[model samples]
Target: METTDFSQPIRQSAKGIIVIFAFNLVTFVKKFFVLFIAFGVSILRSKSIGNVTPTMMVLAVIGVLLIILIIAILKYLNFKFYLSKDDFHLATGIINKDNTIIPKSKIQNVYIKQNFLQQIINVVSVKIETAGDKKSEIEISALDKPTALLLKKKLFRKASSVSEELEQSESIEEPEVFFKVTPKRLLLEGLSQNHFKSFLLIFTFGFGLYSEFKDFLQELELEKHVEGLVELDEATILNLIITNVIILIGVVLISFLFSVVKTFIINFNLEVVEHQKTIEINKGLFNKVSLSLTPSRIQNLVITTNRVKQYFGLHTIAVKQAMVNVKQQKNFNIVALEKEQLDYLVNKLLSNYNDEQGDVAKPRPYFMRISALEMFLFGVVINGLSLAIFGIEMLWINAVFMPLAALYVYFAYKKAYYRISEDFVTIGSGVIDTTTNILEIHKIQSVKLKQTIFQRPRAIASLVISTASKSVTIPYISKSEAISIYNLLLYKVESQDRDWM
Candidate 1:
C-alpha cells in the first residue's frame, strides 16, 4: 500500500453517530444531573399548574433531542483518523479542532471494546493509549471489526509485512492458551473477595439513598411523619430496632448479591492467550474488553492475597506497565487462581520470574523501636485531646486502643523487607494485607536515597526506586545499604541495552 493512500483520513462507522450521541447525552446528564432534575421538575409543575401546555413540554423535549442529535452528527463529521509510518494522527472537534499525533513507539497498549449494542451491530470501539496521556489519545467510537483489527495490528507492529505475517500465522497456527478461569474457581474468588469493603460501599450507598428520599419527602411536605418517629416510647423504640434489623439484613443480602454478580460479569470466561511476543486477554460480559500486552513494556508485577484469599490458596496478580500518569495506570489482571497456576502463568509470561522465595533483607532493628515510639506519641496526642474535650470517662477506650495501635505498627515494621537478585528486586510490605512487588532491575528509571533528621543520627535512610509507572520505597534501611542498592540499580539500568518502556 502506498503511504498517501494509507494515510488518507477516514471517518468512523455510520452507526457511530448514534453511539456518540448516546455517550454525549449520558455525559451531559451526569455532569449536570441536579440542574437537569430541577429544570425537569419546574417544567412538569408548570404543566400541572396550567402555566404550560402539554404541547409545549413535548416541543421542549423534541428540541433538546434534536439539538443533541445535531451535535452528535457534527462530531461524527469532524472526526477523522489515520496512521502514518511513525505516528498515529487523529483530528477531531466541532468548533475548535484538535490534532493529535502520537508516536508509534510511545503507544503503550491498544484496547478494543464491544458493548451489547456494538456486538449487535458487529462493530467495535478502539482506544489508543500512550504513556503520558491520562485518557486514550485516539478513540474510534465505532468501526467494523475487520477494519478495527487491521488498524490495531498495523499501529502496534508499525509494518504492513507484520500484518501479513500475523494473518498467515493465524491461518497456519493456533495461539497457545496459557490460563483460563474455571467456574468453580471464579465462584471461590468472588466469595473470598473483601466483604468488609463491600459492606462499607453498601452502607454509603444506602445512606445516600436515604438522604435523597428524605429530600424528596421534604419537597412534597411529608417529612413531619418521619420526624414524628424520633419521639420514641419504649414500644416505638423496640419496633424501630426490629424494623432496622430487617432493613439491614435486606441491604446486606442485596449488597452481597450485587458483589457476586459484578465479580462474575467482570471475570466471566477470562482467558489468556500467548502469542510470540505478546499476550492477549479477553473477558467481560456486557462490555467485552480485549487488551494486548507486550512483556517488554511491563514495569512491575504485584501479587496480592488477603487473609480470606490466602485461606483458599488463591492469589491475584496485577501487571503494571509503563503508564505516565498514576491515575491512568491500568494494572492488567491476567488471572486470579491457585498459587500453582499463578506461578505457572508468571513463569510463562515472565521468563525471569523466580518461584523460589529467596532470602529477604529486613530493616534495622531500631526500625521497630522508631515505629512504636511514633505510634505511641500519636496515640498519646489523640487521647490527650479526647480527654480535654470529651471527658476522662473515655480514658478506658484510649487505654485499649493505644496498645492495639502499637501492635499494628510493630507488625507493619516486621512485614517490611526487600530482596535484591541479580536481575530483579522484590519488596514486600503491609501487615494484615500483604503485597509483594517485583521489578526487573534494568527497567528502573531512577533511584533516590533519602534521610530524615531523626534517621540521620541512626545513619538510616530510605531508598526509592522509580520506574515509568510507579515507585517502590524501602524505608529505615542502613545508609550504606541504601547507597549500595542505589548504585547497583543505577549500574544495571545504565548497562542494559533494552528499552525501559
Candidate 2:
C-alpha cells in the first residue's frame, strides 16, 4: 500500500457523487413529503379527472433525481482537502468557494464510519472533529479504508516516518477484544431498558399522524371502521377493565418491539476493542461506526441500572469525554456488562478507581418535602387538564398517577446522596433506575452554589458541579454543606498538575 503525500490536495473517490446525490434526493423527498401525500390524496379523492398518468409521476421523479445529481456532481468537484505544516485545510462549496483551516493540535477526534450505501460503494467516511466546532468540521464521504486510516493518522500525526506509515498500512494487527455482546444479552438489555420514552414517542407520533389524516379519513368515511370503540363507554366495569388491559398490553408490546429492534440494529455484533493507547468501538448494522477513545481524555464515568436489570446482573456504563457543547458531547454507551466486566472497564479507564461507597451524605429532609410539593402540584395540573379536556369523568386518571408520583418521590429522596473522596466525587441519584456518576476531582471545571428563594428560607443550597462533559446538580442540601463541598472541589482541582483534556 502506498501512502499519499499529505502536502498534496486530495479529492474524494468518484463514488462520492452517488452518495451526495442520494443524500440530496432523500432530503428533497423528506421536505416535500406533504406535497407528495397531498398529490396522492388528490388522485385518490377522485377517479374521473385522473388523466394524471403513472408515466408522468415516474418522469417527475426522474427529473428531480437528475437535478439533484447535477448539484451533487458540482459539490463533489469543489471538495478537496490537504494537510499543511500544523493545520488541515478544506476547500468546499458549490456556488461560493469556502475554505476552512483547523489547527492539528485542536483536533479532538477522527472517526471512520461506513453506512450501508458507503459499504456497497466500498468507501468509508472520515470525519474530523475539533474543540470549537459542535460537529465535525471536515467530512470526506468517499475514501477507501486505507486512505481513511492514513488521513486519520496524519490528522493526529500518529506516524513519524514514511516507513512506519507504510508498515501500518500494509499489515494491521487486530486490537484485542475487551468485550463482545451476544445476541441473547442484547435481547435481555432491550427488554430491561426503560421504554417510557419509546412509548411516549410512539404515542405522540401516532396521535399526530392520526390528526393529520383525520380529515382525509372522514372524507373517505373510514370513521365507520373504528366507530365500535364508542361502545366501550357503555360497557360494564369488567368489560372496561378488560378493554383497558388489552389496550395497555398492545401499547407495551409495540413499545417493546420498537426498543428491541432499535437495540439490535444499533448494537449489532458490538465489540469493544482495546488498542495500545485508546479503546475503540465497532458496531452498528447498516451504519458501521468505529470510534477511538483515549482514557486520559475522558471526563467522567456514569453507571446506570435498574431493579429489573439488576435481577439479571446487567449494567450499562456511559463513557463521557470533554466537549465544548453539550449537544455535541460524544458519549458512548456500552450496555449489558456484568459486574466483573464493569469493574474491569472502569478500573482501566480510571486507574485505581475505587468502588467503595465511602461515608455518603444524604440531602436534608427538606428535599423530601420539596419533592412532595412538586408532585402534589403536578397532580393538581393533571386533574385540572383532565377536567378541562375530557370533562369531570376523566378526573379519576389523577388517582392512577398519584401512587406512581409518591413512589417516585420516595425513591428520589432515598437515592439522592453525594460522596466526596480524595480523588473522586460520586453523585448517586434516580427514581426506579439508579444512576451513579463518578468524576475525578481534578476534572472539575467549576463549582457553583445555587439557591432559590424558597430554599433560602430553609438555609438550603444546591451544588452545581460542571465538568467538560456536563453539569451535575446536588440539590436541597444545607448551605454549609454545599460550601464545604464547593471548597473541597476547588482545592482538589487547583492542586492537580494534570490536565483534564
Residue pairs in collision within model 2: none
Per-residue lDDT of 1-501 in model 2, one digit per residue for the tens? 988777888788899998898888889999999999888677667632357665677787788888999999999999999999788899999879989888877777787888899999999998877756464557788888998888886776632223566557434766689999999999999998899999999888867897899899676655643664665654555675897798778888999999999989888888888865567877888988877776766788899999999988889988887763553242277888899999988888888778674668999998889899999998889889888878989977867898899898999999899888778888999987899999888888889999999888889999999988878988888999899888878887887776877
Clash count of each predicted structure: 0, 0
lDDT of 2 at 481: 87
Error of 1 at 53 (Å): 4.8
Distance from true position, residue 54, model 2, in Å? 9.0
lDDT of 1 by residue, 1-501 (tens): 322234788898899998988888889779889986886797677654355666776787788888999999999999999888788889999999999888887788888888887887778999888777465556798988778777887787762225667667765777887778887777777777766678888898987898879867576645644665676567667876998999999878877777778778887888888776678888888877888878777888888877778888878887888763553243277546688877776775567678455568998877788778877898889789879967988788777887788777878887888998878888988766678888888788889998999889889999988888779988789999989888888888887777776
Overall lDDT per candidate, in order of appearance: 0.79, 0.82
Per-residue lDDT of 112 in model 2 = 85
